[model samples]
Target chain A: MSNKAKHWEKTKGQMIITMILWFFFGYVIFMFGENINSASFLGYPLAYYMCAQGSIIAFVVILFWSAGRQEKIDEEFGFTEKEDD
Target chain B: MFKGKFIDNLPKIYGTYTGGFLVFIILMAIAESAGMTKETIGILFVAFTVCIYAFIGWLSRTVQVDAYYVAGRQVPTVFNGMATAADWMSGASFVAMAGGIYFGGYTYMAFLVGWTGGYILVSSLLAPYLRKFGCYTVPDFIGTRYGGNFARFCAVCVLTLASFTYVTAQINATGTIAARALQIPFELGVWVGLISILLCSMLGGMRAVTWTQVAQYIVLIIAYLIPIFWISNKGGYGLFPHLMLGEEVARLGELEAQFGLVKNSAAAVKEAGVPGGLKSISLPHSEVPAGGMAAWKFISLALCMMVGTASLPHILMRYFTTPSVKAARKSVCWSLFFIALLYTSAPMLATLSKLSLMDPTLPTGIIGKEISAVMAIDWVSAWTAQKQAFIADFNGDGILQLNEWFMRGDVVVLSTPEIAGLPYVISGLVAAGGMAAAMSTADGLILAIANALSHDIYFKIIDPKADVRKRLIVARSLLVVIGAFGAYIASMRITGILGAVAWAFDFAMSGLFFPLVLGVWWKRATRQGAIAGMITGLGSGTAYLIYVYPKFMGNPAWLGIDHLRFGIIGASVCLIVMVVVSLMTPAPDSATQKMIDEVRIPSGKTILGKQH
Candidate 1:
């Protein structure tokens, strides 16, 4: 593939990730009104616990993970610039 | 001669923090002497809170000017999250939210939804682009992006509207919390918060705010969580379940037996007209399921929280400090995580306290049928020496009846430790955390306000030829002036502290958030459209707030709408005007287009894959 094509693929990937996050966000809101705890794992109310606690934890985790990934992607695509500019 | 030069300047720069610490120590001593448990423990917690503040000061001093302003554009994602948590969790989040949850139930759940979820929108849509541009303030982005001075002025108007009123309220909250927790006059609390804010904010800008906020986040979360855990352990319930049901049931049963429900099955109180049994309005319910509003209240509140989180200036400014678009995006996620720890716990605290109210076991337990009001009281007095303060035996009745909880709704979080009989050490920590939350946000706002005035207004507009050094001096002077103004307004008790902060969020969402969001994400957004939207948002939001504020606050009606729901109305109008106006105006110039393209490229690289 040409370099232009590679850039296209990277841009496509970023868009896809952004869309996926938006979808998950919508899903969380739809489930918000329900009893979060009743959707349980190991007899714990999973949704209840998550809405109350877990969602925030997941949010934090994803932020760091995605940030690291984006930086790597930028570097791989030769998007990195030196400060001398 | 060397000592004289050093000594003369040192007092202005360093003693602010030192003076802040000395004052904090004195405040702690007073709290200990007045009502703090085991004086040594109370003093120890005060020492801990002060130590955290001192460490933040040390960190700020070590970083360079760029770092001091924007964390050297190198802060890691998680650490930034902690700092953002500190930034966002103002007095409103740390103090009033718990009580809101405690009192309002499902209706209040909107707070968590709006606040936590807004980060997703910010990280995905805005933070990366803002960071890529490398601007100092939000206005910088608008001015450079649009190539106009007018845009900068518009930005300043919106920022000032959002922050000035909001900061004053934070000061009010800090004053109230300090006075209540430390046993000082309310004015003293305001002064303490103000001085601390001046110390950190004036010395270093966003960089100082970041480290201090990080420290505050730790103090706040520790202060918030420890009390909840302590309460849960003693009360014998998991955090959420007890809060939801336990206390509610206990209080209900106590109320029922006191009113002679068993003796006369179909009876109402003789004069008060309240029903005798389970349907009593005279007592506090576990939840206000339909707290006197329709479904619209719920929807509007949800909208407010959702939009408000994205709109705050202090929170928005954090994006500028990151090294790249990616870092900013990650920081939002980190922020959500830090916020989640406490935000999630708040409702649970409310639920547990409610459940404890309904628990029909001991002091707050069920009343026997034979125990008329009088005998029930004697039994409670004998059974539990004097721990049950919420119970009152009115009408000379023997039974322990539900009176007011002696705590106002605002005091719910602050009083939780004492209510659960936790050590004074923890209460002191919570007090410090509340102050930190208030001060950090206030300092950030003051910095933003001062920056807009000195850099954007005076230096940029009034004195266009002023040097960078002069502009910096002007910024420092403005910080002191604006900081003092916020403190003075806070002392006046303008409104409920939390409500005022929330109001600022509302204003920002309507006037600022839409313009910025559309400007960054959509190519079609034009200057004319942006200006029109800002006018509609700022105009109606201010008008609605001023007009209907009285009615919403339980004053006489003006057009009959509640103040709480007024924000959504403003936001809706703003969005409508923006869309309509954008369709009519011409697209941005090629220069503006080029600027956009530049920001769109990832940091540390050219989009064309060549060295610049």
Candidate 2:
């Protein structure tokens, strides 16, 4: 594959993984918000606690982590945007 | 403080500004304790904040073409993130989000998820590529990618309509804040807000907007957090409420029971709602498969918002100011991180703030109590005087029930401090923050519409040889014209700010999302195919919006998509038509194909050349 396509290949691979994690934290858990309510932690239902804080925090981490992976992909395929001196 | 380079001196300038703001808060609090009138404190809060924004706008004022449109393409990532966060936190997120979560329960989180989830798509799919494409507007992207003026014009029309719908809503929020803060009429307050909004953007354009948004974010976050901190501490949940509010979620339920606010599903709402009776609390008109629990009713609203967030022209425009493609990508992470600061706290505020109102032991807790007694309370009487809240006793039992009470969601965040009986200064600070939220968003939306019209429609299309000074003149003029028009529409009260915002998101995504995404990813996407897809998508979405509207036929939703979720169908049809049409037509020229590859690579200098 050409360098451009290789960069895209690695980026796409990471993107698929990121999307799954994003979906799981954002949707799948929230969809089952009630069924998981009985499993209480910290004096709150699991679902409520998760929705209130955990998932949002998860989103932040996922964003940064995805950026880090993209940097690696960019470097591996020689696609890094060089800062002008 | 260093004066040679503003960018290098950013910390010094903003640090002093922040310190000065803290001192101002201290003075406001002291003045409140020293027996200052509430109205004086409120006006001072607003005047001080707006003056600060206007000062920044004046300081950044420029006639330079690049700076006017894209902040000279030199904003730092973190500052851009804060600005984007402020831009994202409109009247909806600042004021209505907690209320949405408060009233709708778990299902309302779809918005929180969808909005935040959208940045992931932005970071990976759009922002970096758009930054690499080096365009000033979304329509510029459409025009270049699709290779035609007609496609760009269609994109421009939908952008203006959707963004105008959005701008009017923000102005409505500003009017609400100004009306309460200044004791002026709502319509009059709208004109006041419009002038301040225009002052922030008209002078320096996006450069002014960028710095002003950063300042606004600071004021808003402080205002948002202080009340939550006070409520949590007062309620024994501690300062870090989300971490320790273990049973407080359950406390909300206990409080709900005590207030007799019970309803299992949308079916209950139907029985409880009086025909043509005044009801402003937003209950979803439809249900989802989350057990028909009503909490899950608007799950699709979240899904559409995600796609909509990715497509919004104003939001996409923010990335262009970043220093590099990578910076633009990381800025999405920062945007969500800053946004998360407020969003994660919204549910906490939702439960705790409701508890402040519902806990019968609390002095302001009025539900399930006698109507006359509740009326006598100062905050209750005050909000009721402004027509933001209502209480009626229907059962002749002398006690208030859930059915006899109503409150506008827009007022909940503003009124929470008063309801919780905090210092009047905190309420003033919140009023300042609310205005900041509204004005900050209005600035961005106005600039987006004005820039697209001035840059793409005026400069590029109508007069390609237009100079930098002429373009700036046209842009600023459009800002004033549009701002006044928006204020007029806002005074009419077309719908609640949140409802208008939802429609804006639906319209934005309906027409723009598939074309934008496919433009970058699929080089086969032809100009004709894209133009056809945009028109059909937007047209179908508008048709669905009308069909479901109560004043119209009120048709039942097809495939369970309501008016707010019409993007789901619009985008689906757009993708299918785009794919089918692209294959049936000839490919774009090699130049356009190569331009696609250049954006995808994300390295080296931008494909488009420097500004004149």
Candidate 3:
């Protein structure tokens, strides 16, 4: 029961976040296709940076966020079997 | 940190270094034959690979049979992640992907989406269910879940078809790498690939494959990165610094006065044989419409890869090898992380090369350009005299334009290092890495096919009385046959490595992806539904590829559309069929429902079961 709860807690949030990010990414792609490079986030061409670098950064961020959250959930629910911490 | 593990395993690990020397000798002879002088580099790489493999072997040897198959239901997040990376890299991802980007341009990013998105289905939908069932193979899951021999047979057929198609592509890739790097004939290169795959995989079974793959993950990544670094430096982009902001982009924008500052900063992509000279920036699709696919086509291609990756039997089997649902998910993340490193570089390299290639005075590495060109034309004419050959005189002029040269997509990485005039050593290492990727995946897929035939089909259905030991023998025998058949298929197929590989993805996406995903995740999924889905999806995808694709592309009625697009259409059909049939058929029984619930159970339940 606890295991299911933990998974639901972690996965539900992740699913929502992932879907939102996916849509956001699609919009960015559409924006680039539209040839609209808005003002810079960090002095870089917003469209150019988003297409090339931004997607990768977002991917890494989501990966860490999801992995870390699951780990925490696993710990709270006593699901982990590994030694050490 | 390494002291306890190092001291305990020093003698055995040192013993494994002997095989390292053997691999070194094999590589050295090839390098020497190719006039490559990279002895130290080759030796170092071989040593690194052997050591990692030795470590994995040691780790697995400590586990029991159940653990050997699924890590004893105790794998942690990080280790599973590493193994997942190894599984995902295979030969195609490791070697051919960069080549696609290098040769195909921004359009090729579709492969990345196709490959990665497939995993979304795998992890979010199929993986946990498979884990709950505790089945070793896709066929095992189908047979157990559906409670029928016919379902198992269908699964075996799907597995065999997908694995065989995937393996042949790997063989072709291995042959290409070996022929180019080893300077041997294509036939001999295929033999080398066959021998290497058989020897590496035959020894310790899946145990050996997993360990070797983990080791290969490290070797291929390092090999992949070195060439990129060399090219970046040669083109005036320092490692980490320029990756953030490309120097080649700036250089191209500066060199082309029409584009002004953008000329030195923006990369210029030029066709090989175009005579009008370098364009400032990739002119809009209006100028190079043939060069880019429509956005709809691009999206479809990406969807194919995404769906295809999830469906591939070999990749799915790796998840079954992990201990728990959580471990499987963790592994997916790690695989993505590892793959992302290469995936990101592929586009960067392609863009940079485009910029560099635009320079009118760019070095071609030909000793004498005029003499070489005349000699090459004569060589082509002589070859054509002996046999029919196709050559397009694009510019009304009779002469073959220097820029008109289209490098085969498979040769992108090989030519990239050479294009930049990087040291011969880096080029040789890249070739070895490509070979490693191809060989490792080939071995795994061959093993999967063997298992599908012997364990899933022969022993389970045709001759249920066969003992475990006898089945093992059959499996080994089948491996040899499959390996030989792959070599024969590879010899007959003339399509280049990455192009052929995309077709393998299409087969998986259309034939297996939907069935696997829906069978596991959807309660209403039924045996009849799965069978119909697989057959129709695969049939439609294959027919479309063989017939409709060519027509859509406005080609002669035989030449197919790009295989990736077929994958998207195939996957969708399978998904639609599965849903429609599931609604019509009865839902799974109580036992199956329990199994599904078990898989979806949180990690907490897994630990609780351990306590019991």
Candidate 4:
């Protein structure tokens, strides 16, 4: 495979892993969080708490981390362009 | 702050806008104290705020193609984030989403999760690449990636359908707010909304939409937070509603048990003279779904929503306005942060509103009272007068049973201030905020549809040599026509706001999701594959929705999915079709492959990737 294709493969793998992380935090926790409802967090039901606040916090973290990491990936791969602005 | 031109002016512009808003609020207060009726105050408030937006649109009017098409491609990350958040939160989200949570309970988290998770998809998979592609519209990317007008035309078709469906709902929402605030007929109110939408979008295109949306975001977030904060304080949660909602949940559980007692008592039923009324009484508060099927429905709905959020045309267009690919990625994070401010607060607002309505101290509760006494509370009487809520002692017991109290969920958020006994102006402010949410979204959707027509069809296909002035004329005129059509559909009131929005999301996801995602990621994806995938996906989704869904709603689960979750089936079909078609067909030629590689890079000086 060409170098572009190899880079594509690596980035694709990373993207999939990132997506799986989101799926776990968004879907898995949402589906099974109720199993932990007996537990409480900071005066709130754990399941409801995760659904309302925790999941969003997790999403923000994942997005920022992925964005920061992708910049590094691009730079390492020599794909970064000079800032046009 | 940095010393760049736009950056240097940002703080001054914000200051002026903020000062203007504060002065308007002070004037409103004086009018309220000078004995203006609440209805008059509400109408004046909406009118003043909407006119301000229209005036901003007039001020930012642009004839240049670049400014009209993508706001000159210079929006900073933070302001673009604000604009995007305003554009994303529609009337359904601002008004009905919390109401859905109030009525549907834990299951409604599908909306919150789906929408926010979709942003993850956008930030990771779509936004940066699309920004690097540096095109004007989604169709532009598709056309260039696939190297054909056919693919672009197909994209335009899907964009129009999806955006039209979404815009109609927004117009409907705008009409609802106007009708309630002005005490006018719903039909007339829709015309009022259409006029404001046209005024904002027709003159300046996306440039006007972006700046006005920033203003709308500020108004909307403030309007949303105020009543919720008031409720949180009143509920003894101090200011942190998220942390303190567990106690409210526990208290609500106790109230549910008390209502359940009334539901099961045969003596009470016979005394009330309404047999089988217990079920309706207990049904509204029973939010938890039983067994595995409920979980399946939740996951499917959430999945549909997440994918749908990523696929919507108007939203994708917002990313094109950012200054750089990195700014595009950063804007997604900022959009999520701003949107979370409302989403996290919505459930808390719903819970508090439910508690307030059921509080035994209020006349709204299920207590024994004379009819006159029960009707004495101003908010209760106000809702009943509007026919939004009703109380009837069906059993002749002279006591309101839980079943006897019925309210349309749409009014829950709108009536929260009155229900909580806050001042009338707060309700007026909420109305203004709702209008802002509706108008901001409407402005974006109308421009999306019109841009597809003018840029994709007129300039690119019909008149490739059309001057910038000619293109601007076409875009502006199309905005007027499309705005009127959307308003007419909304006035017809074919569906509720949330239902229409859900359908729009599903439609957009089914048709556009696979093609748009593959276009950027897979270099081998051919024009034929995209066209085939979009057609089959859209065709099958629409066919199922039109032919099978109504019949299936009452039947057992079809493959563990419901009508609302049909986007999953559509998306699955598109993925299979696209992969098969692309593998069977020849890959895109060398030039297209080169362009795809260029899009993959975060920042590159590429000939094809210049801003249009």
Name the top lDDT candidate. Answer: 2
lDDT of 2 by residue, B1-612 (tens): 477878877778778888899999999999988999999999999999999999999988998988998998889899999999999899788988888776766667677777787887788779999999889989999998998789999999989988998999999989989988998999999999999998899899999999999999999999899899898887677768878776667776665555554443445445554322134323321112246333344356666887899999999999999989999999999999999999988888877766666666776677668888888888878767766677755566988776566666655688787777788899999999989999999999999999999988998789999877788899999999999999999999888777789888889888999999999988899998898889988888888888886667789887667777878877877788878888889999999998898888878878777783
Q: What share of the true interface contacts does candidate 4 keep?
A: 0.53
Question: What TM-score would candidate 4 get against the native?
Answer: 0.93
Docking class of 3: acceptable
Candidates 1 onward: DockQ, in order: 0.30, 0.53, 0.28, 0.58
Per-residue lDDT tens digits of candidate 1, residues B371-401? 3442344423332242312232334445433
lDDT of each: 0.63, 0.83, 0.60, 0.81
- Shift of residue B14 alpha carbon in model 1, Å: 21
Error at B424, model 4, angstroms:
1.0
The full ranking of all candidates by lDDT, starting with the best, is 2, 4, 1, 3
TM-scores, all models, native as reference: 0.78, 0.95, 0.79, 0.93
Clashing pairs in 2: A43-B246
Candidate 4 colliding pairs:
A81-B603, B272-B395
| 1 against 3, candidate with superior lDDT | 1
Distance (Å) between predicted and true CA of B275, model 4? Answer: 21
Where is model 3 chain B poorest over a 10-residue stretch in terms of lDDT? B283-292
Docking class of 2: medium
- Among incorrect, acceptable, medium and high, the docking class of model 1 is acceptable
lDDT of 3 at B470: 67
True contacts kept of 3: 0.09
